[model samples]
Target: MTHTWALVNLKPGVGKSTTAVFAAQAAYEEGLKPLLVDADDGRSCLAAYNRADGFKWPVIGLAEPDLHRKLPDLDGGVDLVIIDVPQVEDHARIARGALRYADTWIVPVAPSHYEVDRMFEPPRGAADDSGRYRLLEFFEEVQDMRRSPADVVVSLNRTNRAKRTKTGPDAEVREALEDKGFEVLNTVIPWHDDRFRQAILPRTPGTNMRRLVRELLDRKGATQ
Candidate 1:
């Protein structure tokens, strides 16, 4: 059976596509066949695949909302499928579809309170009337639509060495997420613009990314 993991968040710029691409790269390095599904209308993952000299796995663009139904036809016999879901604020349907389809869900968040608040922003003109993004609430709502509680983990991305230590932005964010009862991943992707931001191929996965991959695979193995 194929394993599917979707990188989702309430807002963009939280390393969703970057995490998707690198996670696929890491999964490929682990000797597993991995396919990347770009479910975001932004098409960032597709563009990255197009620009690469030799992308490791197949990347397809299916920005439609019926991912749970469409993905089986496109798995192409791969062992793993990593999806880059669009931000929930503007693309709720597509995001919800990806959430419903994937067995494992990863929410990549930066170590900032501002970003945290952005995740709670409700969709435009939403009746919530909270004047905030309803992303966090939306994510919880989607869980009920799933057959079971998916293995969801929060990945702290774009952290520096200092912030990742005992007390800093990383610690603060992790605590905040934990307070909300979310499982935060131990592997933290550092702030490396040349490596991660505007990423190019023919490059090796960084230590943090490799660790993240290993941690995820370990969790996958444990469940199996």
Candidate 2:
């Protein structure tokens, strides 16, 4: 069975693409044949795959709004599928389509007041059926459609080391999210040097990403 995971967020630069790539890499290291689907029209994930010299997995760009339908066709014989979804604010249709088929929805959130504030607001002028609505509605509609709630978790990404103190942004964001009844993962991706941003080389999974992969697998195992 193919375990499909979607990395989604309402705002940009939240490390969605980076998380997708690193997660795929971690899955690969774990002896899983991971397929990366770049569902974002920006094609950032696909571009990263293109630039990498020795990336072993198959990465395809399916930026169309009908990704839910097309994704299954591409999943044959794969152990895992990691989807890099577009920002919900701009690509609601595509994001909605991806959510319909996703088994796990991973939300990457930066520890910032603005990003956290944007999480609760629906996209302006968005229809109720759009991805923006699904995001703001906290996947309630998608859950209703599937007859069960999706496995969703928030990953705190690009955290500053100094801000990890009790009263810093990381703690504040985690508290706020927990107060809102969201599950925030303990594994955090810290703000690294420029080398972390460059995806041209085959990346060895970082400690944070390895922990994230383990958490994801552990959750999937417990659910099973």
Candidate 3:
């Protein structure tokens, strides 16, 4: 994991696992040895590899807090150790442990208040799906309070083409994330059907995601 990177941060459906897994697939195509570590016990990354038969590289699976100690031991053998973390509250402890060790992190934002509200862990009931959708109004609020900022290039995920307006949540979220001092990526991962299919059936990333993965690998010099 010498040239390894971790996709940490305790936020589910934020594309942490999606980014980590696809990044591994992309790195594999480039001939870099990347290890996929499922730092979270649930929806584990290693298990997905076994199921996807997508292990173009080796994978390590561990429960909470183990990754913090395991990272040092595994660092020398691989080009990257990409770990997928769980959402906050559910695995905040594990998330903290992995973040403590991540060299670079890929964070996903959906541009909604519910998604953005992960920053402070809003009053449990105040944040429902509808409340989150209202994030456009509080864009400034999201940018002002980042709990764990890092050498992180935040990427927008699950963006819809037919947005409520025209630019969409992805565009809005990217602006807010950048304003918050994050290094945002240029590639936009458009919502696609096949990518989700590949996720369930176990195959290489489709064309669009593969290209994005290649860019990330190239940026990190993990490319051949």
Candidate 4:
């Protein structure tokens, strides 16, 4: 069976597309036929695929409400499907649609007050709120709709190495997430422009990306 993983979050610029690309590449290197679905309306994943010379796998754009129904049918022989979803606050329908079919939900969060606060926002307005509250509600709805708890794995991205000490932002963010009952991954992707700038290039990812992939695979194994 194809294991589908969705890169989702309530905020943008959290490295969702980059993580999706790297995760799919890692899966490919692991002998899994990975199919990357650019479910974000921004089409950043598809753009990355276009910019990368000689990229081997298929990266398709399908940001629609019926993504859950259509994605599995397009799996072909793919062993894994990595979906780059839009920011949950902006495209709840598309994100929720992808969530319904995803086996694992990987949330990429930057260690910042803005991003961390958005993660735990409460549901406030109508169904059309489209804010962080609505985003949280969508996740709950997906759990009920699928009749199973969502397997959510949080990753701290764009971390600053200089401040990785006990009182640093990275540690604080991890503590906050854990306090809220979130399972934050130990592998933190540090903030490095050189590596991130080469995201669209057909080159090997940095150590953090590789470690993130390994952590994800290990988590999947443990869950199974």
- The residue-by-residue lDDT of candidate 2 on 1-224, one tens digit each, is 77889998877788899889888888888788999999887888888877775389888888888887899888999999999999887887888888888889998998887788767665467764454533647476566666456798999988875234577889899898887678988788887656468546545455677777888888888887
RMSD of each: 2.5, 3.6, 6.4, 3.3
Give the Å error, residue 114, model 1: 1.1
TM-score head-to-head 1 vs 2, winner = 1
Give lDDT tens digits, candidate 3, residues 43-128. Answer: 66765677867665777777567566778787676777777877655775676666666656676765665665564343345655
Please give the distance, in angstroms, between residue 116's alpha carbon in candidate 1 and its true position after superposition: 1.2
lDDT of 3 at 52: 69
Shift in Å, residue 79, candidate 3? 0.8
lDDT of 1 by residue, 116-152 (tens): 7776566667765665446656767888898887799
Candidate 4 on 35-72: residue-level lDDT in tens?
99998878888888878753678999999977889997
Off by over 4 Å in 1: 122-133, 162-164
Best by TM-score: 1
* Of 1 and 4, the candidate ranking higher by TM-score: 1
**In model 2, where do residues sit more than 4 Å from their true spots?**
122-134, 162-167
**Cα lDDT computed for each candidate against the true fold:** 0.83, 0.80, 0.61, 0.80
Model 3, residue pairs in steric clash: 1-75, 1-78, 4-80, 10-87, 10-88, 114-132
Ranking by lDDT: 1, 2, 4, 3
Counted clashes in each candidate structure? 7, 0, 6, 0
